[model samples]
Target chain A: MTKVALTPLAQSLPASVPFVGPEAQERAQGFPFKARLGANESTFGPSPKAIAAMQKAASEVWMYGDPESHDLRQALAAHHQIAPENIMIGEGIDTLLGVLVRLYVTAGDAVVTSAGAYPTFNYHVAGFGGTLHTVPYKNDHEDPDALIAKAREVGAKLIYIANPDNPMGTWHNAARMQQMIDAVPAGCLLVLDEAYIELAPEGTAPAINTSADNVIRMRTFSKAHGMAGARVGYAIGAPDIIQGFNKVRNHFGMSRISQAGALAALRDDGWLGHIREEVSKSRERIIQIAAENGLQTLPSATNFVAIDCGRNGDFASRVLANLITAGVFVRMPFVAPQNRCIRISCGTAAQMDIFAAALPGALQAAHDNLG
Target chain B: MTKVALTPLAQSLPASVPFVGPEAQERAQGFPFKARLGANESTFGPSPKAIAAMQKAASEVWMYGDPESHDLRQALAAHHQIAPENIMIGEGIDTLLGVLVRLYVTAGDAVVTSAGAYPTFNYHVAGFGGTLHTVPYKNDHEDPDALIAKAREVGAKLIYIANPDNPMGTWHNAARMQQMIDAVPAGCLLVLDEAYIELAPEGTAPAINTSADNVIRMRTFSKAHGMAGARVGYAIGAPDIIQGFNKVRNHFGMSRISQAGALAALRDDGWLGHIREEVSKSRERIIQIAAENGLQTLPSATNFVAIDCGRNGDFASRVLANLITAGVFVRMPFVAPQNRCIRISCGTAAQMDIFAAALPGALQAAHDNLG
Candidate 1:
């Protein structure tokens, strides 16, 4: 009997995961890591009010979540001071990016992003059979000018940029970002992923302008609100672009419990203030630890810091491997000279102590192994 | 300035939601649904253990859920007496169907299903640019033979059947289903959606066969397990097809709280048994209420019962509208002869009372409006 055949595009695509969770690593190693920092999830838990809301929502799990996600969208609209029509919610930024790509990029269409930027975005583009053009990062920051230039050159349909970017935690000021936004090619849509914006410095994000048809900004509760597992993220864009999501999106995708948790988390300003302060302290601690170990650290506007290993990619890889072996979970950028650094997330004092204690030994082990 | 244009396929598609949610209706009506029986969700609620597990998982929402979903898949495998490779978990059957369409149906591919089967499936097929060929339902049941015949006639890549079916709550026995499975056209996959399977009679489902490359069975926690809001569903299929999901699925889309809740719910067979008993009672109550109103109820193998209004689609539509106005959120079939009936979900005793009280008044109002 002839077996069912996959589409030619599906057959050509690789069945590879974008990012492996720490749980998988723990399973492979037969033990849990002493410090959970990989994947850039907030080590600080979500607000107590959010937890309470989720617990209450648990009993209501028999009813499907609102397909429109009305209450949460209303809360977000009021928070952003934008009309609800300008926002579109999804399971997460990952899911939103997939839908966005499907809407704009057909087979053989061109999309552009930074070389070492979010792999998940690239995965979505590839899954849709879109031709991706990568522009290299200039001085560890996503070079917006270069990206716009490449988009124009390639006649790209979409260009992706993550301000306060992942892996390196580097960001551009609002004025610089505005310049990049203004420079976007007429026909190209700029995807500004602000997943880490809530934790970034005040001027890191440009003002929200929902009238701009050329840009869509993605925001997630995963990093700053400490609800990564809840999988709530949204896009702020022109009403037409936001409405276009209904053409292909799974309308009832969001979890009811997650909606409750995110709404509560958004309202608990005191908890957010506490998290910001804690994240700031943790960043300082991470920087101090790097300095104490005689390593240079990249200035991070997000909750993670990129510590330069002062060597090539191979050396940094060894350091990361040793750190994982020593029960500290950390990751490094995929492309280098960025790969010459290891990325570590901000955690509680106890978790940071574990990382600090493990780092010197991990470095020593890497040196010994290299020698 | 030229705005970034959507792909030709996306541009051709209208941005219409497959189902207008009860919440949207409630919003329009400026109130909440008193008895939400439209969506076929279990009002019996999830197991207390599942609720507890979700409440516990809420505190740990800072970490991303296991991308592999190892523990839940392993548990499902053990429960089904199959290998873990045979199982693939998704955000929901809705999301899985979308991914499945993306995998097998490229532009211009043909897919087959009953005409009034599930609008969401049709939505996915259209979203992927697949041409859907639908056969009319036979005597309120999804005619498997007709579906198979159409699949063969059209050289279709997929055929979707939900048994015991939605809207009509009718089903086929295992032997008949086995015949359909055996008759699947070469290179055509049969998507057996068993969303309400647990509530069906013991002999309703065919034996699980992961060796069959042309068939995939979908199961969900939404109905019998009473966790619709958690959005957990799994597919049992050949390992190759299951692995193919990894190519396009959002790897980290599932919520950790949901995973924990589903795991707990699956292990609590007592709660499931209780839910089955409760749903059976509720179904009987609904049938009795319909009979009292001089309406005929269809034979149901699922949680909901379809009450025939003894009139045309327009009359049934009026009954549904009046029901909604009376705060009884029930739905009716979408197509011709079947649209003569209104579908009501099994609910708690209190909710059933509300539905029962509202049905008489709704019927009277519908008659008055029609006259």
Candidate 2:
């Protein structure tokens, strides 16, 4: 084999995917997983209005999605009581993060994030050849203050925090989050990822403001809105910061029909309310189930329960494997201490019943495997 | 206002959007246009099977799309008679192009392309801080030899060539493309954007070779299969090259419903055949209309026509503006020689009739405006 002369940066990077999707696991196992709670997707469907809109526009799929995603953005602005100028929509918050990294962090630029936080953001940072500075979690929650300190120390261009974070379902109250925002270095942009905010406690979200160019709030319809399959998300910030995305973002990356569906989804708050109620109940049920199994579950403000598996990371690994073998797909934090737990997404009652029935057997199997 | 500092390269870039979508125009005009032919979308619609698949998957919009996009890739590989490893599915060709630019081209890296080939690609290169090495089109066709020579001279890292290309709808046959591919430098990756291949004349596409590491072919369901609104596209390349996309791609970027819709569209070739036939007829109608109007229409292999207004770009601009005012949404090429022509997409016979009715009035309106 001949050595192909790839770019120096490309050659330096390892071919790595952050998560092996459940679909890949199923393919390797040669069978489908019975339940999908790994990706923190909503089990409840998108709003009925969304479905109707998509169906109605299905035949019109030949046309490109409105590049501006005009209607959807208008609806989002109205929903949040913010100006449309402050909103920038993308394929997902994941794509938005990548674009922001490209905009602010070039090769070897210092960027800061929480350790054991969203690996996808870290992946984007690494992808852009940015020097990543990580601040570890404090008591299973992201230490936003430490993140700000790290960013300030490194003279970082970007500092990131997820308010209602994934993998742990722990969040900081907006008031607490604001202190960290105030501490962000003058030159750095604070990327406040609120992907799961809609399902989080009421105080978890900050008030939408157009005054600050250094802070951006990320939101998604994948959580309480139950449209993860639609691959839609947006960023809200000062008009200047929001407009900055236009320089590098894929203008036609959106699906026109999906935009229509999202607009329809946004218009129906009743459906969002119903799903939110269902999610809260599911979270309570999961906590109860974890307690019944003699496991401690973290206090969650989002839609998932992070159950402490009781032991080391090794023990939690066994539990996750056993659950996966049982066709139950769940995930966990990748860092130590937090890795002593497994995270389960809130799902339908029927799905939870399957979980309730399987937990005891899986726990025993995990113990046996560890031994 | 306190200045938020971005990277040096970012500060240098103007926050420019490549294209303003028709929807944006609609909002500016305070009403919707009568016909939607501006973006070169298939107005004929997608396969019934695709519509049905998307509708059926509407309830399952809670699940994120399969990150691997396995089933769709497998089906596409089968359709192309290539191995599954040859494919990398993405949000759309636009998104993939952005990633490709970032992966291969560095700051100040020379990347060669047509001066007016695809502004979206140019936008990506500029975003990545690459110095675009542009060659003007020769007689409305992308000059392969000139592009290759420039790439060799500049030590270009990437080269973009869209065959059966956009805007102008001109093409070089498979033989010509093969010659160009062989001439491509060893280190340079020829991005063969065969987006319009499905609608092109037979023998227009070069035979596929999954092992061709030097070239990557991009295809989309947007043009012929008519699923542009779903926002699914894929690249076919050697295994090693395809795997490189994994290091940075948004793994779950694909919309699950889009995968289903595109897969269904791929399987229904009969619908594609019908669309191709209709497109052929529409192209002929545009040519006839152009002849009647005393204008010259370029020969096209794709679903659009570039009509030479037999005058300067200013006259063509006036004509385009007049056409827009007549409620016929059409676009012209941005580059000078090409801008002497106004490009029109193949719409339904009804839409063509609208264009037909409007063209004479639009030309007169241009004269009136000039007066």
Candidate 3:
């Protein structure tokens, strides 16, 4: 027997990760991927200004970043038009979710989310030993009403919904989101994940309301600002809930270089507009490529389009596997119906060209494997 | 009443930080610190190669860092002559400590540490609802026997000790540390924090033994590598405990630039040697400055010196306050006996010169402030 023992909750958790990175996949496949599109990372890259800022901050990394992340919080506050007291900066949205789950979910507490939403959230809930209740998506979009009903049934302490959702690229606009927020059950808090909001059209997000005690909005530089590797994300909520993060967070966890990069990225609106335009074009290209292959595509409000394989999850899994084998990295939903479609992230023209070239052969191989 | 409720454990935690950063102090003081000689950060800066690597990686921030931290972990493994599975890279040692605490100490579990030791560990213990039992320092050194006895008494799940210790800058040699490790109570893990080990004398750390399930050694780029802001730290331990981090860690939380920087920093041994020589000189200079001010300095094995203020915690607090007012940043221990000394981190010649220039007035001001 090992001399050291893990806590019961920790012992019960599986040593599985939410997502395996493309680098790990490449290592397994024993070759580099030709087109990197698996994770919903912005292939368009961060603002030049952000890159410059990170480079400048690189030499100044000997000192610990301001534990409070003061400057970045101030900048984020200005950008969001919320008081600095309403914001809490974290290493990433994943880290923030972990901390949030720790705050609200103790052992056996209930938490609710869409079945095929961000696995990282469910990972945290399970990590904390929270009993999770998942509602299935309604026509690929997260069914907010069903989620609320489940939360009410389970008496969940927290409810999670991601706008411009992952894996399917489906979204609900402000009115629908506000309605969900309004019906968040008396004692439950709504975790409104807006990680992909910047990629969606305007009116997709509700206005910032720091007065509402039951809702917190999570945002990230990983998508529109294109700094996923920098690991910067923030949450906006009521002052009390925001301040509660201070009780459990790794106070000095942020990277100083990332703070500077995020600050610079937030200041550059033109780069974001350019990225939106580029992503729109890439989405169009992905749709056109799917059309050429006689496949239908899900309408994407985010950086990725879901290509419908017009069959089942197993066929789409085969298509995804063949795509990865063909040196193009892409992902798909894990649940049924949605898993019938393989999700592809928007990439640069060259990457799209590579994906376009690989798809036809990959689809033919999947069909051939049907025998 | 707030609609959102924190878990009972989280609600019980106070919203206090372990350390108020120098940046926050500067903001409060309405000016910047002239000598950044606090927080135990190496003001000498990271290796030039590290800075260059980070700068080069700046644009690549669009892609998420490898969730497994493949390259960095492999390099760390080679550097330590351990298998890759023995290492777990984290955002920093602080984050790793939090995860480790979560793994071992559930609510109401016992954790042991030295009084006036690293408060961040205590902070994490409190955050996890662990009952921390601190043994008083024996002659300004961590009392390993006392810690072990207390762990036995309280049935602690974990014991934390920082060699080349923080706040006091004192340490135990490898043989002494190995003895302590041997004495760790059964079922308790020993968290040997070696954050300052890179600056200590040879033989300060015990040999790496990944088979030892009861001990985990944390190493960082923050001290001698001079990349505190980069947020790169790792643990060497039995593969089971090391792999256990995957159960609770933010897998994609590392900054890509930081991964590149730490990998480059680890490769540049000459830079590390140069830093050690410089830190030794700075330590001597700080001792001399303390003597010149009619104060005594503790024997130090790390990059900082703890100068005895010749009175008590209140006096040392006054001295630290005056130093900050005079534009030199410094810190003090939180608990008694050791708190009689003020801690000053090693800095460059220019920064040491600033501390030298500011010492007399700060001393006088501290004396004057004594009622």
Candidate 4:
């Protein structure tokens, strides 16, 4: 354009975009989906108390939130029974992941993640020029043992493993997860993403530890707490490692009303538990609906259930298109084999009813269109 | 410590931080400052209508926002009369600034700025491993010609200039600024931070350029539109360069409520015009108050006025301390010559009354303590 050039790194980076939004697809399709089950959002919505708190705080949008996010951090500390230094709040786990990667991984440094794990984390690694070594999923689950071995092999400075893993919604028990955690090489900091732990059964999450310097566990209000739109998430870790974020994070990046809403959300664990139950029922309904359509369903511990479509990724994609064209918005895995199953988020009884009603017709259409 | 070292770039970054927020100081001081004007927040707050929109969107918090932020960008395009492709929105101008710097700067690359310009910009340069070359402000104004020369001297990749500049609040006319813009070296990009532009006078801003590949003009609703807490800002540049942000930005970083408030704030230009009027009156009041206290006040097109404290940096620090002790919170420039002044934000008449009541006594106490 102007003959100005960007850095070599930036130039090398393809104007590659992260995940393309459902909205973009919807606009291209020229229609709105009757049911939105994509993006793994909590269709059940955030806690009523959080909604009320945001409503209450709506009028005070002029004042900046505490730069330290002091009150919210205090509330989180009390909720987690940890010291304030054990917590660091931010825009979301996605944003925090970027900061942590930037903190530890330099150009040419190695980092590890399960193949087909959260691409956002990978995007950050690529953004900072880190070398990423991805391990394949074992038996449809993220193999933490393989991840640690690869980390040691690669001499990775960081390794990311999401418990109750995305795409598949499969998980390891807390004891086994901790076993993997304990076996990680001393020099590689483990980033255990517990983003879906709240929806999983008890023992699906490892015990909290703020003194562990070699690991940082991330949680989000976006999932079980159901405030995805609010963009609030936190990382819990050793104080020094946690404080490392202060060196480079946009210090005043949080929204004031979000801090207020998160505080209210954390205090309403009763609501969290209730939504967890609803998600469990929704999962069951989704499984039943899949079986009714003669599709196999995976055992899931997360909010979304992956339905095996008895076909390859291309076939699953065609089915997904059929679903979208039928006014039901759902997504599927990106990699092979796993992409053979379409991932559908747990939705309200009515939204699921719409999906349940439409899936049969969509499947028939896909079958009819098959050449 | 686990001794899992940070990257060389991250390790090289200082443990330094941005402005110690007023809330942090208030906590240290054991009482909130009576007049909260240090950060240039709109005391009048965002429009009532905007708050209502955020409240309306509160329960929808469980849904992730449209990642494209299409509605806001479309509205912004219509409002600014530019193609939607020319605008890119992010968490805030601060976040966008970091991303923009990262886009062009690699390790050891040279970036130029005034010695005492925005510290956060400097923070990003250091964070990205860019070497910072500083040119001292000439006559309390950011010397664009000097910056251009430095760019040519060091083969600088990027330069920072804030029209209606921060700290000292001095500005160059649009014609002078355009001349300086024309002189930016062919390889370098100029970052024009207009964070406080809406409150600025008519001639203080440059005409919007849809084809400016060498410069990215930043504008935000943080100052006059009174959405500082909401954390929304956008950059206007050539389409190709604006889309370059796709490679690395946190695609879903913006909060939904924030989008609502910013959209509403943008829709209500009357509220912004009202804010400008109020800011002007407050500026006049600050000037009169400074004269009453026997100090010189500089002309300001932005929301804040820089008052010459009639002494050096040390004396001004003492005066600022006296004001803090007298229960009024104010800040000053951190570096020499400019630090010989105190910067106060435009607040309500009543807040200025509080400031006026405390200034003479604070000045006297500072003088008495000099012995």
Cα lDDT of model 2 overall? Answer: 0.87
Clashes of 3: 0
Best by lDDT: 1
The TM-score of chain B in candidate 2 is 0.98
Candidate 3, B26-125: lDDT as tens digits: 9998999888988889888999999999999999999999889899999999999999999999988998999999998888899999988998999998
lDDT of 4 by residue, A264-294 (tens): 9899979988898899999999999999999
Error of 3 at A33 (Å): 0.3
Per-candidate TM-scores read: 0.99, 0.97, 0.99, 0.98
- Which residue pairs come into collision in candidate 2? A65-A256
DockQ of each: 0.91, 0.67, 0.80, 0.68
Report chain A TM-scores, every model: 0.99, 0.97, 0.99, 0.97
Each prediction's Cα lDDT score?
0.93, 0.87, 0.92, 0.88
Clash pairs, candidate 3, are: none
Docking outcome class, model 3? high
TM-score of chain B only, all predictions? 0.99, 0.98, 0.98, 0.98
Give lDDT: candidate 4, residue B338: 91
| Top candidate by DockQ | 1
Better of 1 and 4 by DockQ: 1
Q: What lDDT is reached at residue A136 by model 2?
A: 83
True contacts kept of 1: 0.92
From the highest lDDT down, the ranking of the candidates is: 1, 3, 4, 2
Model 4 deviation from native, Cα RMSD in Å: 1.4
